[model samples]
Target: MDETQPLLPDPDLACDEAQDEAAGKDFVDFDPAGDAENPMDWPEAYKWGIVGLLALMAFTVTFTCISVVPVATRIVDDLDGGHASRSASVLLVTIWELGEAAGPLLIAPLSEMFGRYPVMNAANLLFIAAVVLAALSRSAAAFIGARALTGLAVASNVLNPAIVGDMFPSEQRGTAMSWIQLAPLIGGAVGPAISGAIAETLGWRNVLWMSATLAITCEAVFLTCFRETYKVAILRRRAARLRRETGDPALRTVFDVEGVSRSQKLWEAITRPFSVLAGSGVLQSLSVFGAVSFAYFYIMATTLPDILETLYGLSAAAAGSALISFSIGSLVSVAICNRALDGIYVRMRDANKGVGQPEYRLPLLVFGGFALPLVASLYGWTARAHLPVPLLIFTVGVMGATMLLSFLPLTAYVVDAFGLYAASAMTVVIVTRCLAGTFIPLASERLVDRFGYGVGLSLIGCFSLLFAPIPALVLRYGPKWRQRSRYTREAEAS
Candidate 1:
């Protein structure tokens, strides 16, 4: 055996009987390069169908995360008898993010070990139940706990990108991921945009009921249409069928050839994200950049309603309506900028002698990184100045567009760099960003109270400015760093 040979068999190749006999083991894989059962070889329409379902699921789950933002005070007052602390009220929203922080660490790995379909559907069921629980809760603790549970079930956010990676190769992944990425932005924005009106008309409980209803609808469609996309899980099933049909128990997949027990595989999958994060400085830097960028978005989500209501004397419904600008910006970016992500990468790759490197994805990040700080500062100063409603709306819109600019490329870079370990790599990024999303909003009020919107948000913008050079640095040194990384090296070699 060549010492440098990859651990996993080439997914696109047939089982080589001679090689297997030489190695004293039979390993199953996609027998033909264009095997229809292989997700990569599935019909383009079907692959896109899966992406569409994933986008819907992503929107549904993320919708629940922020739908209550517009009605947080109403929820706290109704459930807590109007006596809850400000921190407690904020926790009603932030605790859900805490659940998001914890969920992907467990869920993404489980998806890798089991399969995408069962895990996602199961999480969807849990999310529906959790949202319904939130609607029925009569106390602050119960409502907060329900939100936390809902967050834990937000597997779609973590799994969507991994599923895209499973179905689409590197060349087309950015385009597929752009659609997936658009969902959460739209979901998060639309949630607050409509929830305030719903809460005002029907009560906060109805807001949760609306989220639960959407989740149930998405789950029904998903269960009906979504197919398993995890390559190892699909191949394992194929191997199992072959074993039963041929009565050859020795037949195995490259994943199973090691004779690892389900328990061992599960344990490794669960911990792999952390191990990868611990060992990879590139991943760590990306996680930090993503975390702060994520925090900026949540801070805006949680704070914007109050900013509009207080500074501009808008009604709750009007304040919520103002957030529609975010959706508008996100929509515009997805339509215009996201499609260019893959185009830019291909251009860079072609320029690099027809070899693609993960650094190619970093070009968009350069624009996003520098633009984010400026947008953040603009949002701050515009709000502090009590600028015209249209100006504030435009600023908020730009903020939404800028966030997607940063996040979409960053996600593509991680997916490209990590390859087979993309799920775990994404889990690392998800965990860090969720933690930031969870905790940073808790301080948003204090930041505004102590420093006012201009200085407080400008401070955040300044913090973001420090990270603007990250993409440039990564673009210059990424290949060398990836060469040093066991995970990236294995992914590349494989």
Candidate 2:
């Protein structure tokens, strides 16, 4: 460990066969942004615990956002809106997601420059303040601003899965991801019901207050439970701490390259995600699929309560209760996938003689692609036709299948394909998904109005069916495609 000796190469970059190449590379002069003591190498139990904690944090933020819209009518009444009241009311929900959509494009890349903890901690604080501000707002402008701030804070929720990917081995990714996907599903389903009840019993303002309280609580939990998992960040911090204790400024750490300055490294850290996205086919494909699914979820979320309350003569509380079916569907899918995904992985491995590849994750995606559009078609048609409540519930059942099938594949594929830069790849996923979530709500009512719910839903279903061929296409050409990717090579070399 001589100061002048070149540091060892990133262990993650050096797989079983690449160890020799790693040894011959003069250790690449350690850079924290690229160094690799990734969380994926951690013990299984510890990793799963981290996954559970992050999932809870995600659930809390997402739950609060979706629920707030159900009580928008009450808030609008309290705000004394004239003709513009309706537009103002809708902005409260839309602004939050719009802000969230902007975050990864802005803040996430910075996390790689600094560290995950700093970004997460700052975002959590922003979320709490935004919620508090919204609670105190007496005007529409104030309310809209508060919601935007909250969305900025909630944007970090996108990074949690990337952290989990960093923490667990790729083979065991499905189970950990189950919790991640499950949290959002549960949140989206339960948000309206719980918010509706609270709004009725307490007040619309109290809903934001309650949300602030939850945000504060989650911030505390994250501060206590979360650690810096981005290995390079951990090393950088460790190096600083060591320098402080020893009072030796000359003490070198793994990432302290002689020529490259920290600022240069920071620039690269911030830019790498975009660089990869521009260069890698795998990343581009997964992000597209992930974003589409996210858009569909948000569109459905914004529309469902409105449809239930207006068309079905259901009370706000009852309309919220109807979402329970969606939650049930999500849970059922997770349960089934958790049991089946590992077996699926093993079978793929056996078939390929242990040369496991990313294509293995696609089968689940295929199942989801088929289920999602069909469920949308069912829900749209059944609800529009004024069919029996049982039929609507059956649509929920179909949706559950879609959620189950899609969640594992996109997640697993991204983790396996992205290597150490999984966070950046996921950031792209987050940006696109949140954008879809934000934009879909704005146009969903219009789509339904113009085409009717059944037709609109069926159209979405057809579009989703087009995505079904993605997995097969990727399965056939994925590795060959990866071989041509410059970012993939950097990832493999990392």
Each candidate: RMSD to true structure? 3.3, 5.1
Stretches of candidate 2 off by over 4 Å are 1-44, 80-91, 241-263, 489-494
Query: TM-score of each candidate?
Result: 0.93, 0.86
lDDT by residue for model 1 over 1-494, one digit each (tens)?
11111112222232354366458577777755478887878999999988888888888877877788777777888787878676777788788878998999888878877788899989989899999988899899998999899898898768888788777777788889888877877887778878888888887777778888898999999889988888778878998999999999889776553545778767877888887888789999988888888787777777887788877788888887787888788777776556788888888888878888888888878788899888988888898898898998898898888787778888888878887667788888988988988887677668877998899888878877887888888989988988787778645311
lDDT of 1 at 61: 76
lDDT of 1 at 196: 83
Which predicted model would earn the best lDDT? 1
lDDT of 2 at 131: 83
Cα lDDT tens digits, model 2, 1-494, are 21111112232332432453245532222443533444644566777778887887788787778787676756766776543454455566777767887676656666665667888888888888888888899877787787887788774455766676556655667777777778877887788788889888887777777777877888898899877776556656766776788877765434445676667766665666677789887777767776666566655655666777778777777777777777788788887778777668778877877777766767777768667777778888987898887678768766866865775677666666666556666667777777766765566556677898888877777776776666667767887888877545433211
Lowest lDDT block of 10, candidate 1: 1-10
Query: How many clashes does the backbone of model 1 have?
Result: 0
